[model samples]
Target: MKNTLPVTRYYGSKRKIINQIWEFIESENLEFDSTLDIFGGTGTFSYKAKIEGKEAHYSDIFKFNTLIGKALIQNNTHKITDAELNFVLTKDDNFNYKFFIKEIFSDIYYLEHENELIDIMVQNINRLKNYYSKYIAYYALFQTCLIKRPFNTFHRKNLNLRTNDVERQFGNKVTWEKSIEDLFRKFCIEANSYIFNNNRKNTATKSSALSCTKTADLIYIDPPYVSEKGSHVDYHSRYHFLEALVNYETFKDYVNFEKLNHEVKLGKTLEFESKTSISNDISSLIQKYNNKIIVFSYRNKGIPSIKELKNIFIENNMCCRICLIKTHSYALNKSNKALGEYLFIAKPKK
Candidate 1:
């Protein structure tokens, strides 16, 4: 079966192993008619559930990710029309397009002209009438931004890697040099193609997992990765540009002028991101949904070890099973040959 879901080069996205994960879930015969993907990065896992005719609810802390969830999962039948595509692609003088990206981000992420194009597109997309239309446009824009970046992340200021004439052992030089306008148009079409009706009412939310009161039959928890060395992957710092795009109006207020890369500074830190608190956080989360089935995606050697995770479920009065995907390798961390992907499937004791 052809998976019609449009995949992005998202860090820690499960698009590569989604089918395998689904196969495992199906093989176990775990019963669930609805799913709540708490982290919902790239929404591929939830999309897989949606395609299987389950009611999918996608949630994330970042507004940009929620927009992606809206465009792909919640949006049943909306597709970007050619006229609407052209509207976002073309600049309208009446729209009062600001140069937030162009002025502040010059010599940072993209070429000057490309940054200006991004500024224009963001303004135009905001003027779109339909809610899903705005989200679909932003989805395409985010994909274009990600594809053009060196590491597919805005964590570093590395435009020199694209512009400098040097022998490159890594990176897609051609894709980096491609026109942002063309890339935007291409992704817009790709996002549109992924839209279809699954005959279920799916929803997307931008809220912390701890704050989510809505319960589902199955809760899929794929929290941010915390390494064995206590270092955590800060998605906020990595994708601050996309976050700013979604919250364009008030983004300047949250900008940290101290950072070289101009990362957005949020007020508080999440407990799950801390090495000391991650174990407790996971335990608390599992306890919160103690009565529901949960599939927790994690790495073998993460902050809270697989043994600790198994114990967490057991402590919550749930029967847990650990499944290992030993062949899996991370895209960015290829040097770590010892790492393996894991899933802890837990259901409350009857």
Candidate 2:
């Protein structure tokens, strides 16, 4: 069966291992009435829990990602209406749409015309009064932006990589060439299809893992991974453009002017991205949710090695089990060697 979940090309997305994660949950017979996906990057896991008849509470530090969770996970019966879709697609000649994208983003990330289209569409989306409709529109727009990018990431200032005439070993040129309107509509349809109530109230909150007060029967932690080889995945830096888009009103202030792509500078750093702070960060999380059945998703090659994580659980007086799920390699991890997905399941001793 095709995975119809609301997903984007997020770097650490669990879309591929979702079934395996679910299978693990099933095999353990871990019955839970509710689940909290603390670092809900793409909300794939929370959406899966909702589909499986669990009250899903999703939280993310990024506003853009939280909007996605709100649209797909928390939203029970709301979908973008035909009228709203028409409003977003239709351009009003009389209305003076803001030229933020056309002026600042010209020749940087997208073509001049494409940037103008984004400005216009974003303006139209803001005119929406219904919160759910607005979120769904933004979700579609986010996915549209990802599909058009060369590597589905805004990590580098490389518009030339997509536009230049050169033989490429990777990327879909046709998909990149598609109009933003077409891609927006395509994702809108996909997002709409994933909207339904599982008879449980779901929630999406804007919070950091350390600050989130919500508790659940089960907690899934998919913190940003730091590779043992000293590579770090900073999601805020990778998707800063989308982060800027969601916070367009105050976005100009956050722009890192030194950068060529006009990437947003997230004022704060996450400990999870730092080698020195990772173990402490993971330890803090384990201590916080020590009472719940804590499940962590980690890569075999990640820092705070599998053995280290097991020791952390053991130190917390919890019984831990490690399950390895074989999966495809990520673009970031360019090692030709194989990689394994690790799930660390820890239950507090009674």
Candidate 3:
């Protein structure tokens, strides 16, 4: 009934190439009430699967990504809109128009500088009914703002805005007013898919792929393939701001980060085990679901080495097969390359 939603950019967002990743499922004669997304890095796989007709059951260890799953997959709603953004921008227009520039700062940082705008937003939206769209829009803007922040990449919490004159000259960047964009338009069109919001059964608490073990249909696995460069790609920090988006309610009591946090790091926490370990477990699970075909799309970094995977899945039983290939991205970052991402099509070896 609605367009598909992209998985929010949780750290490990395979969003870079999930389109290529999902063609395997699309070609198959999938039969099942639900699709499971384990290691729900960005929930991209889950969202796509859900949009296509299968009941999507997604999970992630990150408190942030799971909320993304809910926002994008489970409860599709426009948290913002064109009209509301126009209004917010218009109201702030009288100001020097230099205040809304996109500079990086903490939740408290915005409260300190843009307190007036934030206050007005709360007041106006509170007065309106069915303001969910506007509320979401506010978040979308807020989330967008995080990216332009200096410390946003590693998400370590640092005051990275430029100096006074520098900020004065560019303060407008950090304080840019909320505006409607293409995704916002899509948000309007796609928000209709969520007909319900029951966080209990339909949702998976961990990776959606692993938690969804009950079904007897095609099971797809796209575990985190540790990149080929032998280095880890901490997806968590890459999209750390997602935590704020989902838990904005908790941020209402926002405090300043000028003194609290000011440095970001690549040593972010890992939410789950390595891909090989996970695939080993997934391989076993596929054996149990003998009646259904098991499909997997693994890249060089997220899951198994092709040789390791071939040994595991082939020995287990998948007889009939369809293969799709990926050559990796043009990105110089091995983390960006996606070699070996293919759908391992098979019915259990028995």
Candidate 4:
């Protein structure tokens, strides 16, 4: 098994603290051999579970994220070969590549030439025959798009942040200016290092956590963080560009052109429900998998506070244990103070 996961700057990704989370899971003495990561946002936690020789199942509502899970967790043996990488990176004349990314997304994210490259790359990725190969290519392409952006997000149309002549105080300009080919190749190589068989039929699915049908020895729930201050992370808005790439065939139909950012309106998922409803969402999810060991990861500051969550476990007749680990705020946040990362391990009371 590989010793490292591909680096990702995905918002709310647990890549940085997956070890801490896993250690806490271990200390709970939870006898779990298989894990279902329902909200598997970077798939790092599921990948870690796979690394630990468990059957790791990853699921997410967004197609792009599901691609990430498919590439890393589900795909145990497939790695991007040198020939595959060259095929995806190189532009082919036979394939009629559409310039939708360039025409529709011009002046929104990357430079004109960079946008053209994305058009070529995504088209080539879509053309790949193997499921794992296609997902891996998409993974590399998504990473390239993310790394080129100013905030590593598609939240705004701020191409000038990387293009305009301004004194850079923050953000890595060198990384931003890296060519699409170089970044795509680098990320694909990094992704290749993460593929290995753990001798299990691991899988990835695109589904809402509440409605996910897969059950395992342990159910890992790390829903989108909703702050008590009424602020929330809407991943669809932040990473719509990458999401569109996965659904590129129907991309034109879903484009919400009214928004300045031209974000694809994929509609509000359960994760983006109001702060009040999240508690019920949590309650319903836990009840759905109450028979299995349920491990919930959350921030102490979020809505449905740690106390509220524990109450849900009690109401469901499940004994629970909460482990708190202090961690720094996300890189984009102004406040750098450490905050509590809560992991609640609960099982149906005997």
TM-score of each: 0.97, 0.95, 0.59, 0.96
* Regions of model 1 farther than 4 Å from truth: 266-268
lDDT of 2 at 285: 90
What would the per-residue lDDT of candidate 1 be over residues 112-166, giving only the tens digit for each residue? 9999999899988998898899999999999999989988998888999988999
The models' CA-based lDDT, in order, is 0.86, 0.85, 0.50, 0.85
lDDT of 3 by residue, 264-312 (tens): 2222343234543555675665665555666666555445566666777
Q: Could you give candidate 4's per-residue lDDT for residues 284-329 as a string of tens digits?
A: 8988888999988888777887888899999998998888767865
Model 2 shows how many backbone clashes? 0
Best by TM-score: 1
Q: Which of the two candidates, 2 or 4, achieves a greater TM-score against the reference?
A: 4
Clashes of each: 0, 0, 39, 0
Which ten-residue region of model 2 has the weakest summed lDDT? 329-338
For residues 20-63, write the lDDT of model 2, one tens digit per residue.
99899888888789999999989999999998888999998889
- Give the lDDT of residue 81 in candidate 1: 85
Candidate 2 stretches greater than 4 Å from native: 1-3, 329-336
Q: lDDT score of model 1?
A: 0.86
